[model samples]
Target: MRLESVVPLIPAELVAALDHSCGIRTDTDLLFFGSSLDIIKKLPLGTVTLSDLEKFTELVAEQASVPGHRGDEILAGSRRISEKHSQASCGVKELDDLVGGFGDSRVFEISGAKGSGKTALALQIVIQGLLADADSCALWIDTSGDFSAEKTAQLVRHFDLAVSDKLLERLQVSLGFNIEAVHDVLDALRNSLSSSRTVGPAVQWIVIDSITPLLLPSLSAVSSQGHAMMTTFMRRLRELAQTFGITIMVINGTSAAAPFNQSSAFASTNRKPALGPSFTFMTDCTLWLSKTKDMPDSEGPFSVHVAEVFRSRATRSRIWCTFQIRHGVLSSTIPDL
Candidate 1:
């Protein structure tokens, strides 16, 4: 029998089985699943019931799934079974020991007041990824217009990339000031990826140096509508992260309203940074950077920024580490606190 003809005859139980096994969500429409009729031909006749088919259709319409074991519960059970099985990444040994490592398909939000080493960290990742020779390319969306060509050149020189000046030429740098422009650049990037099987090195990382400014103008009202818009924007970012299999690093600034205990914290609060409750929740990982004041005589005048990893899918509990930018390379000075 032709697959197309059998589509209508397939039982609901068979459809449900296909959906669960194929990771098809319940909301998938007939038109979408109809294309997969070929795969439905393998089911035996009379094995599935019309009632089961109806249930499957209903589930698809409602975008509901059969309840089963929760993922978190499974992980907790496994962790209990094997105490040494931690999900942390292979970050720099010392740093990774504390906050774990960056995870694949995750959005990491780094927020701090100005001059808080956010850009430095972003640059560091770009250089490190290049050094790792993961065939990795980086997309740096300079939202603050602070990305420096000279600085990038300095880092390239400092690390001494292995690629010839010609292949190194493939490393593209895009600069954008407004959100629309940034979106346009991203669209171009997506198109490039679709058009060519091997267009430059496989892009593995994307950094938006300071996403706050791009979102600030639209979030002035902070109403439900505004929040919805913000959510949509973040969803797009998440989509890009997944589609390209790239790690997304967004630099965010804190708002003035966040409560502060010390004079320094109060001063930081006055900077009028971005504010949105969902910002913290939507991110897969969040790192808060704050300046350390009243350092001992041994420490320099430069504000010491400490990194705290909060809300990560794969990270360590060792929070609190110091980072410094030397010779244009951002390096961790002390291990975990």
Candidate 2:
């Protein structure tokens, strides 16, 4: 049946004629009260009721579809713009040099032993993106509950951001203790990005404080079901990153055994890939942060070796760069090498 026949079936309250006096396209499908075209097209001809229309409108409004844009094409265009932006920006020189700036639909895994400044780097990205005036927002998925409001405030104060209040409001931190909670938060975040214009740009970065927590439990479980669950979760994360043009940075904790060398620091050891090669393979870039004991005592000062991009697969794999966190700002010593 034609939409015209269905028009009479629609309640008088829900059906309103378009004001074509303004010269807008009236020949198209009828616009619902909620302004969703999807509902108009999907509404059945004879049996559809006002309540059905309302429900359809609500469903579409809640989970709107992403505009169809080619991911590779978008990334290519964004790369040129990001390179220019990175050249002007400070602190991110080493990182920008390596990857030419983080690309949309990319998953970067930062893995190393604990206290490797993974969280610090993630925070830096949030601030730098804001500084670049990209109208971007970050989603901090804190699995470890280690994200500090105080730290964020310090960074805000250090930068003296003119839009401190606005930027702070834009950066959303969701604390999820369990895997289920994490999944739920991720879903809610995606839905918010799809539905709310007020949330600014679709979440530019999704930083999961640690992906290992979810992985380790799944890997250790007694049944094959556990492995399936793990695979499903990782696939979902990849899908989310690709669908929304968002960059996902997941911090992973490395085992005591060295990732590359099998030789144990102690006597007896069972060596394996620090974190499974599966994670390394899944990620677009695998960065390692480690202290450089080789630096002279006078040059390095304390043993705190700052942040280092140890392993980046994009441009060069075995490049090492040093960085310092001063006044809550990450300053890299290495130039674009």
Candidate 3:
């Protein structure tokens, strides 16, 4: 059957041309709706009639085959996405190679025991991100009040000195000790994104220095409200990440004991992220940072930390990368001993 022959068989009154202006072009878009009510809502009220609804099913059955974009378009798009992911960096070359860089619009958690260098890793990532591009901005949410001006300066000094101050200016810090305060910070950020008069560049990353503080107090045995509150907070975090296309890094802690009736958050390890299972569910990637005692994990004077991909949608198997801090600079590969 000729493509043109099938087209004239359908009445023009029954179905108008599926154009971009109408927000539908193919069967896929039309099939996305559950019923005619949704399609009716898309049009001006009363333009579509009961008669149209009557023939809607028949309209679908005899629908003309509309040509979508070329099939090669999907492969091209996938390649572009692959290239973008390749371009994204975690500020550490070795770590980026291991689990792939922190790509767009996702939540990544850095979890470890107390002395395992979680904050250092996150700080390095944000500072590097800031230094890489002048237009790039970031937000540091200080839950435990660990964010320090002097410390951040010390970290960025390892990169470029000429533009360090200018880049540092792009980073904003807010002390959000409680859940409500964090929500308020996000609300303010959402508003800033909406307002045209906003002077500052839109942020690329949001780093939460130790999510444990903001959440631990609420996970109580006496009340389910705590968990409910936690759920709401996590959902909001997810929404902000998706809506604003920001990469979120949350610092978390590990607990010796697992939650009741559930395996460890990362099945390969016994120690679990302290915020409970729901936190893990919300996270797109879990980059587990830990201080290793093994000889292979270290070289000389620097304290070598092992970074493992506990959970990542992009990776299939467990992958680990080693990093160390030398002269206040964090590097995935230790410099010549």
Estimate the TM-score of every prediction.
0.63, 0.64, 0.68
Candidate 2 segments whose C-alpha is farther than 4 A from its true place: 1-90, 196-201, 221-223, 258-275, 293-313, 334-337
Q: Count the backbone clashes (under 3 Å) in each candidate.
A: 6, 0, 0
Q: Which is the leading candidate under TM-score? A: 3
lDDT of 1 by residue, 1-337 (tens): 1112124445445556564554332232232444334434534565455566555455443432323678897566545523321332322444445545553556788777766777777766656655565466778888766778777776677666554343345355677786666767777777676675655476666788778777677665534544544565576677666556666888898766545422232333343235466676777777766655423435333345566664566664325566644454555554432
Off by over 4 Å in 3: 1-86, 258-270, 293-300, 334-337
Cα deviation of 129 in candidate 2 (Å)? 0.6
lDDT-better candidate, 1 vs 2: 2
Tens-place lDDT digits, model 2, residues 41-127 = 444444345567566344433333234668898678557544534422335676666654665456787766655567777787777
lDDT of all the models against the reference?
0.58, 0.59, 0.68
| All-Cα superposition RMSD per candidate | 11.7, 12.3, 12.5
Residue-by-residue lDDT tens digits, candidate 3, 1-337: 1112124444444346333224443333444434666666566566556466546545553553333567697467545545533456757788877666766567888888876788887777777767665677999999987678987887776677787788788889999987667767887888797788987578878998878888788688886656755665666677677666677899898886533213323354557678776677778788777766423434345667777776776674367777876555677654563
For lDDT, candidate 1 versus 3, the one ahead is 3
Q: Rank by lDDT, descending?
A: 3, 2, 1
- Decreasing TM-score order of the candidates: 3, 2, 1
When 1 and 2 are scored with TM-score, the better candidate is 2
Clashing pairs in 1: 12-52, 12-53, 26-60, 98-318, 99-316, 100-316
